[model samples]
Target: MTFKVGDEVTLSTRAGSRAVVEYGPYGPNGDIYLVKLLEGDEQGEVFGALARVMSTPVFRQGDRVAGFGGTEYSIVAGPFTAHDTWYVVKDDKGQHHPHGDDRLTLVSRAPKPVGPTYELDGVTYDLGARYRDKDGDVWRFEVINGEPRGGMNGKDIYGYSETLAEVQQDYGPLIKL
Candidate 1:
């Protein structure tokens, strides 16, 4: 298979992640390729060094590669309740991390009612993402989409957002990259 740097490739198998190529090493013994894989992405690239080429390579940046078996993510769909597992409430008889695990953490933010989904540029994305409610709590909804900006992750799938009241007043939610 032909591949090159700056290529946008996905897993051929059930791979979860995608990446832009950074390096490829080849030699008389065999050919090797290096790719940057995102942690959240599950699909990974695969090819044995001993394999023989059967055709001309034509891979470029943003080309979709197939058949990669990558890691999967556990995206729980729910109104999740996170508790302080380590800190004990003295009067309520609630015990802190009695096992000394010290795994307690504070809630950064919680998500509100995530809305539906939308698509742009032939891509789909979640409606509500990185949401912050009236209480200053933040939450994230997994409206998945493709890697944009050539595999950069900061692009919000929903574009931009406004409050329900603002949206109603304006007749729609604000969408921008």
Candidate 2:
């Protein structure tokens, strides 16, 4: 039984304890498995188990799930297997968290973001609006080729948002110009 990362399997040592394979095939013949226990007193702890102790993950990418708390919903970002397998999940607040599958329950999928443009307060300021920062440097928001762009003193500012509040937040105090 070859166990890959993110595979859900039962631990022989822990009896009915379920775990997800974090890494494996480490020993001489490639049978030792590093897994995170999913239940009992040792829940959430990682341990090295043999190949005969694990199974496979039942969930797939894009699956909606909620943590054991079951309050907030999230989407599975898929398993990341670098040093260990981490089931990555993106929550409602757009934050990602790693968890064992045993700690998650299937839930209704959430809606995806429509696009980059979003309403902040109610007023959508026009592009090309100029503002002077605290340092007295003037910046302007411009849309070139239908894409939002920001420039300060003839230099392009990358990752600049087309919002007034964002401009103020990034460049410090700003006076409309």
Candidate 3:
């Protein structure tokens, strides 16, 4: 692929070496890139290298990234020359997929919800979560459309809570029925 100025690249012959593409192509050397080396003994040095010998890897190995389709992938290996600087990534199912740097975007990972699902007394609760009512009865709480609802048989319709803590506070062990 054609590279423009400010693109991060590495050389095919040198491992762990990085550079930044400076000037655009010019003349018979139109395929050659003018770059400032970012690492190695040649750090801070400016030189020209053939475009075919340069690789542009957008991220380091072991980064969690997402493609345009929103599929999450873990970068396993790469920036090696196999037609180009390709990154090997693994999916949730442990399947391996290859991608170029330009195809991915770094994204923040979402936190997994906690809870083991609870079933106590006659109440069945999802995620092992429960609250004690004023009558000393156990109730399960669920959030629906941003509203916290409570019930005894996994269907809370009698009591409503603005938050999970509110449900516990209003109907907890400390509260009297």
Quick one: best TM-score, which candidate?
3
Worst 10-residue lDDT window for candidate 3 reads 153-162
Clashing pairs in model 2?
8-56, 9-55
Candidate 2 Cα lDDT to native: 0.62
Q: CA shift at 71, candidate 3, in angstroms?
A: 4.7
Model 2 agreement with the true structure over 65-124: per-residue lDDT tens digits = 778777554555544333334487877888878886667787764453322442235645
Question: Which model, 2 or 3, shows the larger lDDT?
Answer: 3
Per-candidate TM-scores read 0.26, 0.31, 0.47
lDDT of 1 by residue, 78-176 (tens): 111123111121112332212111221222223334446645445453554333333322323333243211111222225343333333234323222
Question: Which has the greatest lDDT?
Answer: 3
After superposition, the stretches of candidate 2 with alpha carbons farther than 4 Å from their true spots are: 56-177
Better of 1 and 3 by lDDT: 3
lDDT agreement with native, every candidate: 0.32, 0.62, 0.64
lDDT of 3 by residue, 33-135 (tens): 7888764345578888788888766666567899779999988787667665678888999999988777878775324335444344454445334554565
